[model samples]
Target: MKKKLLVFTGSPRPDSNSAILAREAARAAREAGASVEVINLSRLRLNPCRACDRCRDRGPGQCVQKDDMKKIYPRLKEAGAIILAHPVYWFTINAQTKLFLDRWYAFGGDEYQCFKNKKIGLILTYADQDVFTSGAVNALRAYQDIFNYLGAEISEMVYTTAAGPGRIKKNKPVLKEAYTLGKKLVS
Candidate 1:
């Protein structure tokens, strides 16, 4: 059976570089015979976690909020691999992305094992003229730290720089890298 992969783009703007990178990877994964789905956070109405500890005390890994997140939980459970795609925003993920990550606490804390053994990848884009100062790697590492605690193995991390409002469209090499990474994931 083909692997089920979920790609979540943390960029608030649809079709932004972060999402473009994810599309490349998802396209490659599909070409390689993996079933893929990409969730654009910009369009989702996900509320921030209230930290009431209700999921731990009253429910089975369910959040109290009634929103688009209810549709996402099942997808997370069904995915064999999960990809978090985002642009480097002030050395970290977007505010909504940070909120989404924080909301994962509803999974009965870090030891819930829902994400254990899952493969993950990171795709980041940035506009820093200097590659070293772009902070993409640092931002990616921040994501890894959370996934690490959840026992999710990061299969790969892809970065693209000098991407600002369609600038990445001129960089075919990086796009190819994204596509190749996706293809390799399922091959």
Candidate 2:
């Protein structure tokens, strides 16, 4: 079967650097012959996980709260690969992205085991150009740890520095690298 990729973006700002990178990566994934779906978390009415543990009792992929995440659960399970695109916020992922990921706990327990060995990609944007000093480093590590714990493999991570909206477009190298990372995820 052909590979299916799910790209999720947590940037609330339209035309933000992270959004641009996510869109570019999706285009490249499509060009590489993978089915792609892009989900903008900011546009969705999603709620944070309540930690009720009802999902664990019900079965695999079950959640108690009813919200927009219902639409994402199926796609997430079906996806062969997943890409997360977000701007650095307070040294870590934005609230939207964190909320989305926290819900993945619904798929936990022995009854649910779909997330093993899935390919993962990350596109992070930060205003600080210095990788070490920027909050991006901590964000990247957090993502790496989460993906690793979920039994997923990190295919690639593309970090770009852009201070303003649409500013990343001027950096050809970063754009090219994002596209290449997308292609690599599928191929």
Candidate 3:
């Protein structure tokens, strides 16, 4: 069976550098024979977890709020791999991405073990020249730590610095790296 990849674009901008990179990766994944779905979180109305302890007690299939997140839960469980594409927001993922990650609590403890076996990728674009900068590396490392805690494999991490709007398009190496990462997901 072909692997399924779910990409979450955490940029609020419609055609921003983050989304562009994610689009390129999705295209590459499709070309490499993996089914891909890129979700624009900006357009979705996702709510933050209420810290109600509802998921922990009620468990497994229940989240108290009935919002757009209902649509994402199934996809989360179904995806063989997941990619998070976001611009460096103060050296980390945007608030929107963090919100979604927190809601993963809805998937339950042991029942959500499906996520443990999945592969995860991180694609981060920043507006400053920070290749040697610790900020971007720290952000990626935090994500890697989370995935590691969840038992997910860190498939790859692609980072581009000083990228804004159309600037990423001019960087062939970064784009190729995204494409290569996508191709790796299928292998």
Candidate 4:
């Protein structure tokens, strides 16, 4: 069976560096015979999690709020690999990505079973030269903790400094790295 990859683009801007890298990765994944879905969080109607612990009472993947996130829950469970491609904001993960991830609490009913043994990929870009200065380090650390807690494997991460809109396109190595990561995720 072909692997299915669910890739989330966390950038708010259309055609953003994050989106570009995600699309490149998705394209490579498709070429490598994986089924790939690329979803842009900024374009989705995802509401923040209410911290109401309703998912525990209702069951895993069941959240009270009716929104696109509900639609994503099954996809999350079905996907063999997941990738988050986003740009750092204010030295940390952007709001859009956080909102999406925060909703992952809905899977807590199963103790985050959906993430266990799953392959994970990251494509992070920032406006600053250094990862620490850009706050990408903080974002990576958070991902490490989350995936580690869930027993997922972080297979690849491609980060770079793209100081402005479309600047990431000039970074050939990062682009290739993203594509390579895609191929590896499905292999």
Each prediction's total of clashing residue pairs, residues at least 3 apart in sequence or on different chains, is 0, 0, 0, 0
Off by over 4 Å in 2: none
Worst 10 residues of 3 by lDDT: 130-139
Tens-digit lDDT track for model 2 on 1-187? 7799999999999788998998899999999899999999999988888988898888767787779988888889999899999988887788889888888988986534677888999999988877767788988888888877888899999997899899999999999999998999999
Residue-wise C-alpha lDDT for candidate 3, range 1-187, written one tens digit per residue:
9899999999887558877778888899999889899998878998899978777777664688898898898888889999999877876778888888988878754656868779887888887786446377767878877887778898988988745577888888889888888878767
Q: What is the lDDT of candidate 3?
A: 0.82
Q: Which candidate gets the maximum TM-score versus the true structure?
A: 4
**Cα lDDT, all candidates:** 0.79, 0.88, 0.82, 0.92
Weakest 10 consecutive residues, lDDT, candidate 2? 108-117
Q: What pairs collide in candidate 4?
A: none
TM-score against native, each model? 0.91, 0.96, 0.93, 0.98
lDDT of 1 by residue, 39-149 (tens): 887688988889888888655458888988888887887788888887777876777677777767878644657888888888888888654588766777677788878
TM-score quality measure for candidate 3:
0.93
Which residue pairs show backbone clashes in model 3? none
* Ranking of predictions according to lDDT: 4, 2, 3, 1
- The per-prediction CA RMSD against the true structure, in angstroms, equals 1.8, 1.1, 1.6, 0.8
Candidate that would win on lDDT: 4
lDDT of 4: 0.92
